[model samples]
Target: MKQLYISFILLSLSFSNSYAYQNKTTKAVDKIVVTKKTQPTKTPIKISNAIIANFVNKYPNLKTYRSDLNNLYLKRNYKSIWFGGKGLIEFANLLYAKTNELEQEGLQSKFAYKNKINSIFTEKTTKNLASVDTELLLSAMYLFYAQKVYKGIESDKIKEIGWLIPQKNLSYATLLSYLLVDPKALDKNDTAQFNQYYKLREVLKKYRKIEQNGGWNKIVRDTLVFELKPGDSSQTIGQIRQRLATTGDLHSDSKSNRYDQELIDGVINFKKRNGYNEDPVITFSQISRMNIPIENYIKTIMVNMERCRWIDPEMTKAAQYIIVNIPSYKLFFVRNGKTELESNVFVGGTMNETVIFSGNINYMVFSPYWNIPTSIVQSEIKTALEQNKNYLVENEMESIKGRVRQKPGPKNPLGKVKFIFPNSNDIYLHGSPSKSLFQSEYRAYSHGCINVNKSEELAYLILKDNTEWPVERIKSAMEGGKEITCMLKEKLPVHMGYFTAWVSDSGEISFFNDIYERDDRLAEILFSEDYN
Candidate 1:
């Protein structure tokens, strides 16, 4: 009886302890629930139409985003997108990060309210989310980024700078939809912009870092010309070596102050890259050009990047295309995504700048007659006729349509052949009777047409696939002394563009003279405070 009594007591004591513990545990759980319920979490703000209207009216600079923002809100029924049921969307953070990296993306433009927009992230608060300012600012920034990166300068501004290529219009609605689906849409959709822009963007970063670290020393310009020759030692020689080393044109700075063989090779490389005819002696003009601040080169690179943005990326990837860069005075024949041939070319003079446009080369005229333009006839030929009555016969000239045209002969201005792309500009690629011009470094003496140094080789390449026109037949046609027009089996696209900075297939950066001074006008517009 005593054992049973003792066991019952222990069991009752255990049950009492267990009951108290259960009550304590239940109260702790309730406390946690209460705490969670009282926590001050951010409540998503309602994006009402009235609030949007008020914000839009207050921030007039963001007019570009107004229509798109309105459509976005109406579609979502006035719910905040950047800020959601959970503080902020992931895509909002992504867009913010991209805006911060505008410079690295080759954009020098600024957002008017960048600071205010950035503060939203730093001083993140529920109240900030409640208002529409943050969202509207983000919208504006997105437009600005898109404009500078994908769209480039405004259409009117491009037209003012004489860019005839069609401007690509990026749809904000489509971009937003893509972002909603994948916040990384911007980087993934790089194909929308020219690939060269990205390549140059990488190059730009290196140049920018170099600029920050203090660019190359300016070469002396007071001297008439740098009479630099191998084995010549002088103060100017030392400066030249230093300049070349700074630009990576020379392997290293020997500090010897001697114009050695290494310096000669370096000068040749520099001259070739700068569109100069390679020469043994460095000229005064070359020294003056080297003296130009590296900052100017940076600006040129930026300007060409803007040009790259203007191009259609797909056009560059065509199976066969001919691209003529007027500023560089070079022509590239690209086939199957590789540069098959490059030729030195003569473009227009300053007064007769080549037009920036694209055309399809479908015809070739062998032994083409040089029908002198009316402008040339009036300005030059008429006076020559008065000076020499027999000048017509002397030049193998005849009258047709009240205009003088050189007959098909060795003396004809259009040597051997010409490739025609029908256009209103009346420009065509042809061989020049002044073949000596091909040897000159600065060969921009033509009226407006382009003269190919290797015109015969170009003809052979163009008609290579056609068994009917072999090299012999082509040569025969060119020398037949009659104007013969033949249509191509396939029309090749030819793009005549003006770019002062270019990157070759081997990743060498080449700079050319801005013959028409187009870069200055573009820089003015690009650096304007009012630029959008």
Candidate 2:
């Protein structure tokens, strides 16, 4: 009976194993096969042809936009589902947003519904197509057009948009584009606009480089030290430090007292060499100079390089010329390619800013007359007339029908001689009795005219070749109190410019205070993304 039971169990086990193996083989066969269906492989997003046609028809000028939309549809039209066709859907949304004819409510609803569609191309489609340069250029062109339209249309809405124009960035972008396209095309002789633009580019390039090199991370700790020669003695240090202290660099502190006298003397010598008054107390300015990043110096040099390129080529070859470096408050006279003379000059006051210009020296007047500007007469003389009826007489001022004038006299604002250049703005070079004003670093104290301290010397130099007048003869002519209108043998060029930073002739970099606050405005525009 046991043997019969064992045989039955063996037979049942064999049957169970066979059944499991058949079931496993059937499952493997099912996994190996891929079944075919009638559905398409790629899905398409839903876009109404009517809506697209209406949009294109409304903006007849947008043929290009419509064409791009058509291309998107043709490339991805295989998909059946609306959301799956990402490119077409995105094109539809952009069209809706950019179209002015679409009702705001309808467009908003469409945008909201379309945004729900998930696809690979969604993010790319929504990106801003306007690049920095393109936007800046467009903004500038629009600004130029808007001004013309603003003049024609008296509507406040038009004027408001015109006023909202980004002028600074636009101007910078336009200048950069011009330079990059044809740098040589910018006249080297026209320093006014060219120099300003060049300087701006330099500053911008420098700031960008600094930002690129991890910004202030590269800053290293440095102590101010006087530049020394290989075999200099230490005795002169204390005196140098004292001089430096007077110039606002050194503080009265225990830490400052620890500075060795040899170090002080070396700093003083460095200051003297670098065009600062010989002072030894190390101040913040000196510290800044010592610690300036290499990138900043590079930018400074580049800024001047651009300036050199922008300088009017005409000035470079002028036989005789006067250059007023606005930042330096100094005038340089070049005769036959040599620097003949230099003197301090007082420029326009803060309220009456000195304008950059270049013109020929047509004539000069001894004991010159002053023609007060119309704006000045209205703003200043009008107020003075109220205070005292004889105000004009007291100041040697006479009134014409609509202008105020000053006669040639001791009390005349125009001291001795005036160099007349026929400019529409009525600006000229002249001498002022307020000689003390020239001593100040911030010498903006004139009425839009340049006042030279050594006018007699300048007059002699300008007229020596043409007038047969030696220095003595020129002095005699001026002392005679006669207005002399001598024609220039060759009309000399005069250039007035503003530069806050420049490289000196000796190759040392120098920085001047931005007395006119012009640098900051320019910097803001140059450093922004749109300007690039």
Candidate 3:
């Protein structure tokens, strides 16, 4: 009986000890899960279904980002991303810093829910971990930034301004994938936006700094066309030197009230940059442009930077292409990244603003006929015919298929040749009879088409590769006294755009007249929030 009691007591003690150890082990497991909730670990914590559901309900417009976020968490089983035991994740901090400096990236919009993301750091404590929603918020803001900066303003918004170059489509999901592997790719992946946009951003910073530092003095408008020859002494000369020096057109301001050779050279450089006739004389018209405030220049740079963001950098890398800047009244022919030829061009008049678009030039016509549009016929030609019965005979025009068209001759408005790029706008690049307009500083005198100053030369260069159209044949056809059309062996792309401010490949900046007054309309939209 004594042996049986001792054995029962021993067995009871063993049972109690085993139960206590099991209870302790369960508590230890619970503690491990609780600790991991505040820090990153190999094991992940389950986020409440309510957190994601609530975020989705609140920000329905972020459906794409929300879907991405759900997939991201689904892959990791809903573990925290923007939070760890130390508090906010390193990537979250880096992205926040970058978002705060949006202006440096040529962006002016406010980040959504910025304060809430910031509060994660500001309100963090030893007892409190980051909110479950913090990761979603950061991810959402990142998507917004990527869309705005990389994709630029929506296609419809740019189409309102007649830009139809087909904005490049970007994938934010790809960006997220990169960040998943290497978070630092946010800084390294510059291909998201056009390379020119970043270049313009650097220039924007410099212009803004200049504006902040009191900028250049506005030249007092004078009625007299000041033609300051060398050795001419006047207070206006000193002021001109000072103004040019501010823009780096002059190395230094001599401060001597004389038109020294240095001032003359500076004027020529200024004229060339501004698309003037390259004459050393400073006319009243030129001075009027010079008096424009530096703040306006800064605004021009900003607006043009926005325009740059809309371009696809890859388009600039085409094997052969032609680009025309309406404001600058210039055309560039590029092949294999080298400028083959440049020509002075005349864009549309203010009343008939030239469209901004791209097309492929597939054919050329030598000694083309000017087919007068029905609108001009009903409006102006009818009146001219009423005044003079022999108007068609005098103008070398004849009725062809019930339409009055000018014959292909020397007197025809389309001088000798025309390049055809099919578009709905009926716009073509052609030579003009009024060659004197090319010599002028401002050449916005066209009805709607572009007038190429070197059309014959452009034709020769474009067709030189084909044995069918040799240089002699091209020249002979241009002056052959009859209309001849030649289809190109290979089509070339042509892009017509409006840029009031342009930064060249060599980093030289040039300003052009806003002939169509587009800058103000675009500025109104860009700075709409500020005005409000």
| Index of the highest-TM-score prediction | 1
Candidate 3 colliding pairs, count: 0
In model 3, pairs of residues that clash are none
TM-score preference between candidates 1 and 2, better one: 1
Q: What is the C-alpha lDDT of each candidate?
A: 0.78, 0.50, 0.76
Model 1, stretches more than 4 Å misplaced? 1-55, 70-85, 124-127, 131-133, 175-190, 221-226
Query: Model 3, which residues run further than 4 Å from truth?
Result: 1-53, 56-91, 120-131, 176-190, 221-227, 530-532
Candidate 1 vs candidate 2: the lDDT winner is 1
396 Cα displacement, candidate 3 (Å): 1.9
Instruction: Give one digit per residue, the lDDT tens place, for model 2 in 407-485.
Output: 7767777777888878876788888777776666567777778889888778877876654666776676566555566
Spell out the clash pairs found in candidate 1.
Answer: none
| Top candidate, metric lDDT | 1
Score candidate 3 by TM-score against the native.
Answer: 0.83
Error of 2 at 405 (Å): 2.2
What lDDT tens digits, residue by residue, belong to model 1 across residues 1-532? 9999999999999989965644443342212211111112366556766776777688777766677677767777776666655555556655666666667776666677765665565533234432457766776677677767777777887888788865565676666767678755666466577777777777787788878989878666436444777777777878988988877789998997778888988999999889888876877778888888878888888889889878877887778999999998889898898877899889989888888889999999999889988888898989999999998899899998787899998998788889999889899999877777788878788888999988888888888899988888899899987898879989999999989998765666889989899999998887778774
Q: Each candidate: how many clashes?
A: 0, 23, 0
C-alpha lDDT of residue 521 in model 3: 82
Q: In model 2, which runs have C-alpha deviations exceeding 4 angstroms? A: 1-300, 400-402, 470-473, 524-532
lDDT of 3 by residue, 1-532 (tens): 9999999999999989966644443332212211122245343434644676778678675555666566566656677666666655566655665666667665677765655655544433334324555567776777777765666666787899778886776666666657757866665455556666766777787777777887888666444645556777777778888999888789888798888888889998898878888877777778878888887888888788778778877788789999999999999999898999999998889887788999999899998999999998999899999999999999999998889899988898888999999999999999987888798877887888999998878888898789999888888888877899999888899999888888777776788888888888877777676421
